[model samples]
Target: MLQSTTGIERLVLVPSLLRSLLMYLQLQKRKDALACLKLWVCSGETLVVSLAKEFYNYFPENEYKLCNFYGSTEIMGDVTYHVITGMDQLRHQDKVPIGLPIDNTIIYILDSNYRPVKTGEIGELFAAGQNVAAGYVNGRDPEKFVENSLAIDPMFAKLYRTGDFAKLEKGTIFYEGRTDSQIKIRGHRVDLAEIEKAVTSIDGIGKAIVLCYQPGEINQALLAFVLTETNITEHQIEEALRQKLTSYMVPQVIILDSIPLLVNGKIDRQSLLKAYGNVNNNDISFQNGIDYKGVPKDQMHAAIALFETIASVLGKAARSTISIDANFYNIGGNSLNSIFTITALSDRGYHINISDFITAKDLGHILSKLSNDRKNAYLSGQTEHDYTSELLKDEYKEDVLDMITTSFYEKADLEQWLMPNIYVEDYRELIDAIWEPLVDKRLSLVVRAKNGEIHGVALNFDARDEPEVEIKSQLNIVFEFLESIEGPVRDNILPPGKGTVLHSFMMATRSTLTPGENVSIMNFMEDEVLKLAIERQFAGIFTTNTSPLTQQLGSDVYAYETIHDCQVNLYVASDNTKPFAKAPDSQRAKVQWKPV
Candidate 1:
């Protein structure tokens, strides 16, 4: 980050070299970042403390910084996680995050009456940001997005109402558990009450109540609390589940209990916690450590099998072999496979998390990360000394820029990163490229911003050319700016043409950037493009993903067939006699994403 007032900057190294530099920064005593290079050496998911001890030569992390991210499904994936500097607070009492929100994002911990609660009190986490996803559409009900209206902020455009819990820590965010019962373990979300209902419904179970407790001393192994009149052992329950449940849903334990609830009618969970507290996530097979070849070997058959498995699950074709290094997302991996992959790992005795592939370079890297994670889950927390770094106070919490790009047809080997070209100076040259697509029409351009300091410039390119423009214009301004950049736009940005790709030629600020800035510019740009598309009367419609710009579109300009892939995996108790059986399932949402 620019430590001075001058924010404009340039990168001189290649992306690979840049990665090396980043690794160095991460290793610095001051940079509080994890050593990802070291973390990737092994299979990188579902790791346990026991496995790390067995293999400390490879898996060594500062125990003090073992953070656990938490938030809601409605907001972005993570609102807060455990922190290195605050572990002492948690050991004494429940310590939550008071961390800084993401760039251009806001969080409002509101009370039931929709008002701000005291700093230390509990409330729902309400978030607002460009990172927020569109509202859920399972039914006709509008109760989900009703957390509150968008409250404008000085720096960010608006704040979203996250239905999760979070608190401020120093300046970073520390997350508590959710306001409701929604919980995600290793990235797989399951309702405890729902699981209990299913368990009780089984023939022999008289009553059941599922309880989730932090693994602490006397904490039962990561599992389910079952109360059944029939003397069914854990083995019997597990055997029953083998036929009916997906491996990920299985509980590690199925304890016999005489008392199912307390006098207050609540599940007597404290006694259970006291009985088997501090249970580790290691009771599963995936936590035992699995070895995988880092690179996809000449196993044409293995790649084919993987592709087939994924395709069968998603009903897509997999005749093509995916590169071992190819990302699942850039290639169009959706949420279905995201969930399916967890079950897939558990099917193989591997526990995994969603972040493992959030920007995974390729299948090989992900396979490696998953391998490590499995063997290292619930390792000793980071030590306090390790968390006392300058980087914690001021560090660039970087997220890999995984960009994907395509044209007309879907492309495999999804390898696009929206990056800057080495020589681009400004956005104008980028805009100039659009002129090529608009040469035939009497083109007029529109650039948006409050002042002449432009944020976006639209080349009202006319796409309707008879034979196409024979000669490209040297006067193209946008293309020149693009060519001057140190690197071109990363693959993640939209292609030049789209159903309608709306983007600022520059980084649009959360506040300064408004739909009005885009609409007026796009309106004129479309008029010019309409001349190119040869649709003189095409002023009535436009389409794009739901965003500030898209939200600005007239109510009639909406989307349809927004494909959502769904899946429901019935899990079982690994140590139980009749753990999981073919269980009832719920289709969560259509999956989105492909390996880029």
Candidate 2:
């Protein structure tokens, strides 16, 4: 209808609409339709320099002009205008300038205090002119339309706070981004537009949009969606961003074949956020979004269960979709949350050791290690010895303390790092400090022989509710190292609140028993601990294994998963020295968990 009308010399549209129309015309070979238009006015959104070049290529710079109009409805449509007469205007520009004020409109780039910022300094764009709306309906948001503090004329007395940020350079205003787009991330004030610019500048990325998910929350994340022209992986984009942006400013990149757009041609940001939430949160509608490509037919059931469980635990905080090739850490799984994933998987009748999950290169690697069979055939006939596991009683307290002290001081691999600096008295003081709570919680277990001799002890506490004890001994170094590894896991990943996790703090066995006998006794004690967790309605058992024997049993024999492993010698104390420097490189402290 518009093409048939006479004297149609000018066209006005949003930048998105113009781009869409131009693409359609090029696709249909209908460049003649644009011939009637002498000029095109693009507004509402920032005009890409590339898009402007494309326009002139089709319409011919000699015949038509492209003008960028910048304004909002509250400012009576447009307050500033910039015209591009040829490709030369866009050659050296990073962004198309919003240009100078139109007619009687006055534009001011002001700081937070409403004072004019120096030229070239980015600030909020405030406008004062006859074009500015008097006020909103019912005086809503009266503060947005304030008195023009620097105005000397009646026409410029009222300034409309555009809420947009821009900078004036050499008599021209350049659009920056919305004021709300600037946010604090990990103590750094980040500009989302700046990140977006950096992303789009990378080769093969056609366009990019960056958005923050769950802003200001503990699990808050910045996500980047890129429309790419090549087979670029998300990891590659993230790595590129790390080089150009600050570490915290780097976002989880999600590559798209095509950027989703609304009917009016604007980027569908809400839809993008919703789709991300659905996939990450394990919403039933999007469960198929998980890729099971590398999974075997036999493991399909386990894969589905594991992937869905991981999604449920990670929820919207997950940075990427659950996929067979996705690394747990890259997809938002951490040591603490790995326990939550293990527990969730266990609930579904599938189990894997935390070590196996942690060490697995990808979800497919984890799937190969996943076991649906809960029966421990190897351990079936091993319990022939006459050892019974029971709760620790005050009668056995002195024996338990002695056993713990002797085992840790003489045989513990982790303490070997500190060796002579650590004392037997240190273990006694530590045992004394935790003795009260261990007795009260009733979670600790002890293995006793038929002759009433206590052979093993497993000190347990509620993971979320463990009491804070102050240690004056050098043993505090070990405790600090433990906290450095365990604190983040507990606070960030595990289910919040108490009663969900039973922390198997310290486990020790008497040196009197042979290695095989020690394994059997520890196995029995672990089973009893699992039973106790079930009886107490706790979700799982959390523990760290510094001894090779316990670490082996936790993963190979008792089915506890290893979530994280830290090299003993890598531990640096507050004194800025490697306290465990003498420890072998192979010696590691493995954080393990067993789901009830």
Candidate 3:
């Protein structure tokens, strides 16, 4: 074996030694046994992360790689293995996607009843390839690997199942855990890897291993063994995790060490748990009205209650025990819901940046390495580097005022501002589409144009996630953008300023705004079209802030509440590079045209 910095390399060097051994062995005349070096398994969610590390470390620095093996096990012996880069980005996140479909491979994931769930939903992965193994050995459970009805149509060939759970997002199949590894908590099957992922996301801990600990006595609680640096303290470790993990997924005990694996190369779950007793056993509680009570939790069950509360938020089964520092994120609280948790905490008189959980939740071990305080904090979340080039306080009070003033579009000539440039036929079509719907309602969009051309457009409707056409898909972004641009208008949409719940599945916009003209157009939309939607009884309005119609109106006519990215399936360019536009289409971008 050769020595190395990253880890041991070339554990089996079969060259010069084989030359000498040739003298003793009869098989020396023959080369080594023929073995196909094809990728046998693409690491699935059922596969542990340690296996990935092993494969990576086993090969030479530039030689090791991730390959995609395609085709069903029934047809062929794992027909294809396509290698690719960009796996480093996903190494610490979810499953690594090797790439697209390979030659002669039909990979599909199916449900228990063997029906396709959806285009991108999670299912049991099955392969159909030329070299897949014909069948399993020695009375193996047939149903687990067999499909009676031959799923892929037209081909009609019987396919063997891989039994791996996976989901497709944006056309990329992502592996989930095996159904066997999945644990049901409160009617939801939980992926244990997801919990482990959250635990590892905590900074300062080098390695984290979670074990299902049930001593055949009390309820099941997770036991986490962490490998970290020497300076980490127990207290800091507990707190660091609190930011990222919810309650139930947190381990009952955390054992810290410099190394996590045993000599046999397997995780030493037993050794870590044995060492956990020595660390500080004091429980930290967030009891109401107690104000940082230093008293131990042995006398009070408040900490356990809080733990249960956090677990409920994460939808985890009520665990028997949990560590105080467990991060909420790793336990299935995504960035979106983590923000909700922060809101909940804020209402309880504590403001926390979920990022602080990185260091603060380090079980007192890694908290010392933190450069900044990871406690009660309030932030707008939009990074300074993201927009204004600096992270600010919870509110950007001064700049917000200036932004509002600059964003205003005053349109004293309302009708001319409504429709800037449009042909009469198209304007009439748009009018007919809205005018009929409004006949049953109170108000309607009155279309107008210079020569009967449609200048701009506006509409109103009750919110819903139905009908996959038009602008319903962008309802979230449009609403958030409107809220950020106009608060009073947003409030006007919500009856009694409360209890109006909504998610948009439809919305549409036809715009000529170039990338350079986007900001200007936003000001106009906030000032004009959106205002018209609210005046006409829209619960929320969505239109660019700088449309010709909006520019005609002044800034004071708009007020917003919040604005953020609406994550969706689309190829949104990283750079705001405007698509090429013909001259006729380019004129539509000018802020002077009004919508009829």
Candidate 4:
């Protein structure tokens, strides 16, 4: 019926409703009805780039223009306008600009002191113009309407504070957010709109809304509701945010199929919060939401217990679904909360090390690591096999070399920086150079399966008696990097003796083993090494862990004391190049030791 209407040259609608209409028109094959619509004015909320791109795709003729109108009721409707003639304007923008003020309307970006902010600085928006409304009828919030401090003309005598933050660059005004959106998190002030902008800027995110749940209380948490068009998980979004924002600024991301909206087209934030509260308020309803399709009957009891513990900890902050395939981090588990989950599980007689839990690909893998008997059976796959740690042997050299080459090239974190510059020959050469000393030290250990295949290797050396070998390959870069972080601790922190400190130089597991299996084997090797250290009357065992799995085991599971920690990305080599420059700030090399 609306398709027959005439004289529809312009349309003013909220961005959200416009998006729904555009999608509907395209789906209904009614694009021709919009031929008379020459302009679309979007206001009431920020128009994200994703929505703008949708509009651009729907109307490619360039005959129609999209304008962003910015204003409040006190400003007598829109006081600023910007027109998008083509997609080029949105290519580099996160949000559509509110643009220059309308004729006879004056806009000022001012700081808390009411002074004009410099160009590109964000401040509260204030407006003074002929269209400015007189004081409110009830005379409430009288401070909002005040005498214009910078007014020179009689028409600009009244100024209305918009209570919104914005910045101006080259005469174009960009909306920042509302001032009331700021809240304190862990003693640091965080802007929900800033977090929302970051989340929306991610490549596949269609929309995002960041809200604080239970503010000013002990259970307060910052939550981000994201609508994504891709298969990206909550963990991936949170990791991406960690790269762009500080640790405290990162919010727990919840992926959603659709966001609730009000009749006026704006997001219904209160409904979103209420829904979260409802999900957490009822335990039976929450438990029913978990997926248990793939869980084994034998492990069902333990899985349910673990799930309940996790639910108790995460509560309202969990992602949309919980299942055997879901990752702990992807389901609202952070490092701190992970510890809480672990402690809760321990109380219920379920046990798994932090490294195993942190590195598990999914909850099913974590469930396998909860018990030693089950872990060994799970790692061996079809048939259970007895694995044992044995001292270094001459006949196992070939198998050891193969494991080292594959593990270092494919899984080692530090070697990844050198990339194409590293080769299998480098590791072969490294093994050859150190082979003699490794055997003589009698400190190296390897884990062998029932089939006599070596799956894990740990090469150790006395802190003061280790032999020095000349390395001629790019693998030397890894050694140099290790020495730069490990040398100081050996020279100053550890005990000064050839037999007093056993330095764990290199440890690697087969490339085919799952992360949980790798941790199990490594744990066995570490235990055997400590026994050997105790037999030799050494004061302690010293090691440097670069991989995140080993780092967690050393610190959290094995109770090793950390002596020195170095950020891998911050290390500059002798060539003055940061080989690990692409590494995340959280990546580190930990020098740790456990006393005998």
301-376, model 2: which lDDT tens digit per residue? 9899988888776666566668889887666654335656766787898877554565567898888777866553
Candidate topping lDDT? 4
Q: Scored by Cα lDDT, where does model 1 land?
A: 0.36
TM-score quality measure for candidate 2: 0.52
Candidate 1 vs candidate 4, TM-score winner: 4
Model 3: what TM-score? 0.35
Of models 1 and 2, which has the larger TM-score? Answer: 2
CA error at residue 497 for candidate 1, angstroms? 83
Ranking by TM-score: 2, 4, 3, 1
lDDT of 3 at 373: 29
| TM-score for each candidate, following the candidate numbering | 0.24, 0.52, 0.35, 0.52
Model 3: residues >4 Å from true position, as ranges? 1-82, 86-95, 98-105, 130-138, 148-156, 185-189, 215-217, 233-235, 256-596
In candidate 3, how many clashes are counted? 105
lDDT of 3 by residue, 1-596 (tens): 11123423222211122222323332333322111221233421123343344344332334444454433335544443435333353367445543455666667677756767797687887765554454678857675445436545534354667656777677666666555555432112346667666766565555566666432111234555665534675446656766666443455335553434465444555766554423332333211111213324452343434343444433321222234444333333332233333344444433433334222332122122212222424232212211111112213322322222222211111112222122224323333344433334322222222243222222333332112233222222323333443334334443443212122111112122221122222333333444454454445543323332222222212333323222122212234332211112212211111121
Clashes of each: 149, 4, 105, 0
Tell me which of candidates 1 and 3 scores higher on TM-score. 3
User: What's the distance in Å from true for residue 486, model 1?
Assistant: 78
Q: Which 10 consecutive positions of candidate 2 have the poorest summed lDDT?
A: 376-385
- What C-alpha lDDT values do all the predictions have? 0.36, 0.78, 0.38, 0.80
